[model samples]
Target: MQTSTGNKPFSCEVCGSAFSQNSSLKRHMQIHTGEKPYSCEICVSTFSQKAHLKSHMRTHTQEKLYSCEMCGSSFSDNSSLKRHIRTHTGEKSYSCEICGAAFSQTVNLKSHVRTHTGEKPYACEMCASAFSEYSTLKSHMRTHTGDKPYSCEFCGSTFALNVTLKLHLRTHTGEKPYTCEVCALSFSHIFSLKSHMRTHTGEKPYSCKICQSTFSLNCNLKTHMFTHSGEKPYSCEVCGLSFSRKSAVKRHMFTHTGDKPFSCKVCGSAFSLNRNLKSHIRTHTGEKPYSCEVCSTSFSENSSLKRHIRTHTGEKPYSCDICGSTFSQTAHLKSHIQTHSRIGIKC
Candidate 1:
């Protein structure tokens, strides 16, 4: 069948998306109407169009109807096969007028154009937040509706997005597709491996304006900024103590509940906090992962490495509140406080 490519005669009334034919517009309308007319016989999976149901059947049957002659690669649909062909031929028909950037598919080129134009065609009616892509807008809409369509068969867990669900499936399957080249370290997600790569590269991209301190991830920088700002958002209800980090508040909750959740497999030692359990685990394993660039010294805990750095820089940040005596370690300052107590007076 000849492909229909010309001025789109039909358009969607709900989202104002243009379509080539009335049939295409009708299929698009089902998205807004929540209507699925076509249903699969095997899985009972429903779709808006008969074509989609036919395509979905291939998943159950494990059939590949279309094949690439160049690479001998098989695909369920002709469109997918056509897109795969571009990889071999290096042919990109869809070109952006603004940037001259070419992409294999017209959809990708359209998404690329949005970056240059700053055009967000898809907008969330609930939040008024606009997105350059329709898929992103669909994900954003989930926040308002609290709907999770994608569900995991393994653990009865549901996710707002299919990609999130896919990642969650890896937890059950132990599928670590993303792997590091340097250390051969595997990650369930690509972003985790990217963040892991920064450890080897020492690439701290996210920086704080307050102290010029950098972090591997943006979230770590955000948490670090809370420390500089003295913003203790997470407050303990039992003790009325505020903490800058939610993890600290979580640890504090264990103190009230007397719940030791994190346990060691080796020695059966238990701890309230995960970080403390990880530190204790190092004692059994004798693993000193954190290393200093200067003098090539290593420590089991990150706090120990931090204190070791003070020896080189002579950075005595901890000060005795009673006697005005400074020390590199807080424990040293606490130990000196005893001396002041014996003297029968302090600052």
Candidate 2:
């Protein structure tokens, strides 16, 4: 089907693909030939199309001409500015018919559609784990390779992607735009605000197939499954120590590096993570919010509440990586290793 008259009508002889202009047809031919005529001056990168090469040049230039009216922040392109404008407008034009959920962008709508359709088209060749989108599959592949391309300009903190780098930039900027309607609790990112809203709505969308237990997010559901499956995917190459979560592995790296960033404001005691500092704060405040529903027994920390619940459920989820031994707590499993291990044994 042809539209109105155009200058040059170029039709593909092989695939029947037609283009309005001859130049577009010539550019399209490079895809089949695998030819990259455009090359980057700064790096060894090459592109088949000239437009992609122009966009790549913006990275070297650091030139963001497009500015936001609301936030006064600049972007490299017009599309990025348009996406930033949606944050101010709160206008979700693209919506899902199945769930009646709306999103700002068409790409995000397509990703959300996979949740309803259960269509995971992209799969990992090594593990056969599926992903809804090609970009997510690319990020998942980086886990296998341990590739961190995005690095901070200030402290040299490395990230897997540009979005993660942007989120990390917020810690330096102190810009929290996403605010809650209920509590007025602000977050640096819109995704963080959406996750915080789940606490108010009591919405647990992600559920386990085995126990039917629910979670607020897909990542939480993934972490919860590790308890049942005993899957420790992230492992230390130095000592062969395994962990269920990636963040746990990152914190454990502090032991090797001797890095303790978290410090108490009340006292001079230092800790590895913010959660440890939070648990330490309970000693001063004497606050025990997590209480047992059955016996009304209170605990200083939520981990204690979880351990106490295991007494009722008889769930010893944590298992040894070396042997087949299981225990309720990870600390207990660590202590149990001494029975089988010789003196001066690492990990």
Winning candidate number (lDDT): 1
Whole-model lDDT, model 1: 0.90
Q: What TM-score fits each model?
A: 0.53, 0.42
The numbered model that scores best in TM-score is 1
Clashes of 2: 0
Worst 10 residues of 2 by lDDT: 1-10
Please give the CA lDDT of all the candidate structures: 0.90, 0.89
**Model 1, C-alpha of 307: deviation from truth (Å):** 10
Residues forming the 10-long window of minimal summed lDDT in candidate 1: 1-10
